[model samples]
Target: MEFRNTLEFAQEMDTKDPLVNYRDEFVFPKVKGKEVIYFTGNSLGLQPKRAKAFVDDIMTDWAELGVEGHFYADKPWWDYHERLIPPLAKVVGAKPGEVTVMNTLSVNLHLLMVSFYTPKSNRFKIICEEKAFPSDQYMLQSQVRFHGFNPEEAIVEVKKRDGEHFWRTKDFLSKINEVGDELALVLIGGVNYYNGQVMDMETITKSAKSVGANVGWDLAHAVGNVELKLHDWNADFAAWCSYKYMNSGPGNASGVFIHEKHLDKKDVPRFEGWWGTKKEERFLMKPHFEPMPNADAWQISNPPVLSMAPYLASLELFEEVGMPALLKKQKSLTSYLEFILNEIDKEVDSSFEIITPKERGCQLSVFLHGQGRALFNYLMEHGVIVDWREPNVIRLAPAPFYCSFEDMYRFGQILREGILHNE
Candidate 1:
């Protein structure tokens, strides 16, 4: 449990690591000539070595079968998305029928909003965290305007009480209670992008549903980073992209979930598309829309086999290790990073601050005292792979699948040498 040095630390943890074989599974990033200690999987995950084979499988089908690839290939395009649903559903804690991989994140958010956000004249207001990811804010703003309402009056943003870095659960719960009658929907980010705080999803979902309001989650940062119970918690719906911790590659397909309870109801207002029709009768293509009876009903287009390929590969890793084990490793690795960062702070009395909450999903946001952009560039150039958010804050995520405790120790040394000593 304890090591006197970084090398000893890494070797010990790696020895006990159940998922260590996963390191060979990925192509870690190289800096100069060496494999840099990669700690930015929260921004973009390291690619799986199997990704090429997965993508090639689809390519091979296309080359050999041509137009018949839809139904004739090993993983036929006609049923490709189905191949991923069981594992995908298990990862997010939902029934297989309740989840479907679909378009990109922002696009799926737009589609879910169309059905979920029905602001009546009296109850037209929505509640959201202030400074949500810009993309989400833009989507909500556009949706409000398109529906002939002003976001100024329709959007209620909750901030940290006075000057706290993250919103406390009580603050959000109180606001929901006070405004519950007038709130039509609550759209929230599962993890705050700037601060790395994991929102209390179950409590938030219960409060929103208690007031008869639809709730949706943007799990862009939460999906693979933390354990979620979507069905047990009764979330109305949710959506997220797969490129980050899921390691599906950049701009890979995203997914959406609608509770099965909503699937059979014919009264819910939603945009209808050919892909949402029942698979057996899809070719018949009747004029009236009878949806496929679950989240699959949310799809508007056929599956893109190329994007789903890498995701299928990633999903296999999740199934093999299972989420509980992954989450356990994540907690230990992340705590190791935080411990070393604190040690550096104590040793140097430096002004660098880690404002990210301790309960965050496998990430810590470091705020530098000097010029942030310059300091961040120095770290990257020195072979410590991490990402910087604007104005300030560097995000370092020591992903459990491949990162070791030594990576954190090395990163801390990089910080102490690069930024702390210079001060």
Candidate 2:
């Protein structure tokens, strides 16, 4: 499809878009009394308009039922988290029995490591990508330290080629083979937060297992943004936050995926609590810990219904539109954005080098060559909401659920004007 940098062309594409109406479902923040072009969905998603009502229902139920709300609420707070399973499962391409909602991303990763990151005297090294998200880096460091090992020796980082923006799959495969018997686990972010590159999880997971290593993914950027098959990929475990593309809220709850093969195993080591036990035996407070038959076995506490409410509300949108439709729009919308960027770069004296590779989802991490923070500040003041990384890179994720083609075109215009103003 030929792309144009005109408002009419953008509007025409929106008119043809099947998911265009979803833009209205979210409440965007205003800058100078106009809705800003939000491009930071990779950092935090806009609030779903329906989220307020979902929270209200929980608030009203608590007011009416008091202590009995756990059993008497319309959705029954005791089991509210279960309602999120089916839709959340569908979004991540896993069976309902293989997924559950729980603590935040880092917390869940720590818990999952208890089951999957077992290291022995000879096999103790973990393989991960170079420059992983800070939380993941800290978590892996602490985990290896707790097991009495130096992080420098226990963690094998797959480095990108010098001067390249993204990692090559062959390098990871070669690293796994080099580490060989010493590799105990392979945990890396599915979609790199810095470069927006989607790792080839299926191939990497296969290679990791062949070397007797457990594989896991931190899907913070990948979960709702790209296609995932945690179950089919045979990933031992994975975790993601809901506040990004999932559109829950700031620092909201997270989702977990545990393979069916790991569920209901009494011998599997885990940090257990009452909520993880079988529901029938939970009230009994029995002496033995009988785990849930599914992924909920890893849960350590009762569900936070208030936090889960907004997530459930967002999943309604997912169920209605489906990931397939979202992915289809995402490809076209992102392609149009790339075209707009190229067009703007040609017209301006400054260079805009998109660092995000072709394997990306909705995000485009562009290096603003010959430009500086003044341009980013101008963009923000002019009602363009985007994320600025250290140095001159800006991450723009035009989420398909709410972001429009018009936003991309308008952003290109604002960006061009900002560059010209700075000169």
Candidate 3:
């Protein structure tokens, strides 16, 4: 962890990285004549090279089979959707039928809300984090309105205590306990997008469910970045976009999970769609709505094969590396990042601060004292890619599939130069 300023140092770290070969699998962006450093997997991940071929296979089927592609061709579009189930289920630690690829993130959230957020007279409030992704907040507010309630009165949000930006698990649990009686649903981001905090979903779900609340998660930032056990953890439901850690391309298709226990529960209501009907019975064109069991019941329409292609490409790679080992690599790489940032700031001693929790995921959210945007733009110009949030915080995530120890080294150079030159 010594401070070194050259790509040679980066090369040395890369040589030691057991997961180094993963870099060759992706298409890195180029700025001018150089390879631009991409550290914003917190936002969008780099595309895998195999993604094109995956898409092309689907295209060929569409051309050859025409209408028959639904049940014919190599993958057979009729059962093609199920092909992704095994891989998606494995990524989230669920049984094969417990997960399904479908819809965008917020759309899936609304559908899940229909089934799980059946608010009763006593347990009539929804709980979530403050400053959740805007789309989620919008969906929750609109859903609250749809249910004949004022969001201001029906929603309870957990924000950092005092002036802090992150909450400890103990504090989070205590807050849940305080509102145990009033809660109907607890929907939390698996990892808070702003601060890079990895919420303990298993612990949180257990705490909430014990108190009679439905538990769900939005794993946009956590899906492939962290190891999840939605089924074993007994999470009632969860949804995620495939674009971030999953690297499925911009606005890629999403996936959802429902514990097997809910498959035949007549009590659970859902927003009905023809696509969700039993496959054999779906083509009958019957008036009755018979749902396919498990998370597949959440599907609203025919699967978008084009979008599913990249997700397939990404999921296959995740299957190869395995999530547990990938996480171990993440901890080491991010720990190195944290250590280097602290070391550089130690010399300046009193100016910059990294506000993210010490045990955060791949992203490190830094809070600049006064100079934030200026420093961020400077880093971009120097080809040290990262992201900036409103007012001050900057997020940098070194994705496991493509990011390298070398990325951290390069950013260190950018950070040192930006801070010193500004001073």
Candidate 4:
């Protein structure tokens, strides 16, 4: 597929796009009375137009049914979160019984660690990627400290080699081997937030398991963006936020994946709550904590139906267009974006270094050599919504659901003009 930096070529690609119509499903923000080219789905997805209807239903049900809404609403609030499991399971590549919606990403991670991160006198070190998301880093540090160990000693970071933008699989595996008997758990971001590099989860999971270490993933940037096989990979647990690619509202509820092998185990340590008990026996209010037979066992409270409503709305779109179709378009769309970047770089004699490797999803984190924050401000003012990292990098994530080929082409034009004007 030859990509051209022309309006006609972009429009031709858009015409042939099977997912092009989905752009209308979302409500994009306007800049200067025109829809901006959105490239921040990795940060916060655009609000789905259907989200309003979903929320309205919940609001109406609450107004009419009051306390009875838990049992009497059209979609019973008591079981509302279950509606999200089927589609959410498919997104994360897990069985329906293996996934559940719960608290936010970091909160779920902390709760899951209670079950997976069991430290001993000799085996207490945890392996994670260097420069993980700040939330993850803080969580790991606090968890280690709570267990009476210094973070510098208990947490093993797999640092990228000098002069490299991304981590290598071999280095991670080697680090796991070096830790050997001391490795208690392996938890890293499935897709790095900074470089947009998709880690080799299957291989790394295998290696970590071989060393008698529990494994998990922080899929904040990976879920709904890349292909995942959490069940097949035998990951003990994983957690992700819904706001990014999942298109739930800001700081919305999160999703979790717990392997079937660990389900229904009475001995597994977890924070217990009434909602996590067996459904039939929950109302009985028995004193004993009999866990749910699936991933819902980890849930610590009743479902937040209001937060889950928008998520359910977004999953409807996922169900309409399966992940397979979304992934197929993602590859082509991202490649076209890369081609446009290279073409613009050559045309302007500018150094636009794409740090995101080939093993990536929709995001392309480019280092604008000799460019500054002024260029990012210029692009934003010109109706290009991209993310600016510290120093001189900008992350452009062209979400397949709403972003179009013409958005990429137009971004290239804006980028060229910004460069020229800055000079």
Candidate 1 structure quality by residue, lDDT tens digits, 68-131: 9999999889879998899989889999999999899999999999899988887877889999
- What's every prediction's RMSD, in angstroms? 1.4, 0.6, 1.8, 0.6
Clashes within 3 Å, all models in order: 0, 0, 1, 0
TM-scores for all predictions? 0.97, 0.99, 0.95, 0.99
What is the C-alpha lDDT profile of model 4 across 1-423, one tens digit per residue?
777889999999999999999999999999999999999999999999999999999999999999899999999998899999999999999999999999999999999999999899899999999989999999999999999999999999999889999999999999999999999999999999999999999999999999999999999999999999999999999999999999999999999999999998899999999999999898898999999999999988999999999999999999999999999999999999999999999999999999999999999999999999999999999999999999899999999999999999999999999999999
Per-residue CA lDDT of model 2 for 199-286, tens digit only, reads 9999999999999999999999998999999899999999999999999999999999999988888999999999999988888989
lDDT of 3 by residue, 318-403 (tens): 88888887898888788778777876677666356677786577888888786768888888888877898888778889887787
lDDT agreement with native, every candidate = 0.86, 0.94, 0.84, 0.95
Q: Clashing pairs in model 3? A: 70-78
Residue 149's lDDT within candidate 3 is: 82
How well does model 1 score by local distance difference test?
A: 0.86
Tell me which residue pairs clash in candidate 2. none
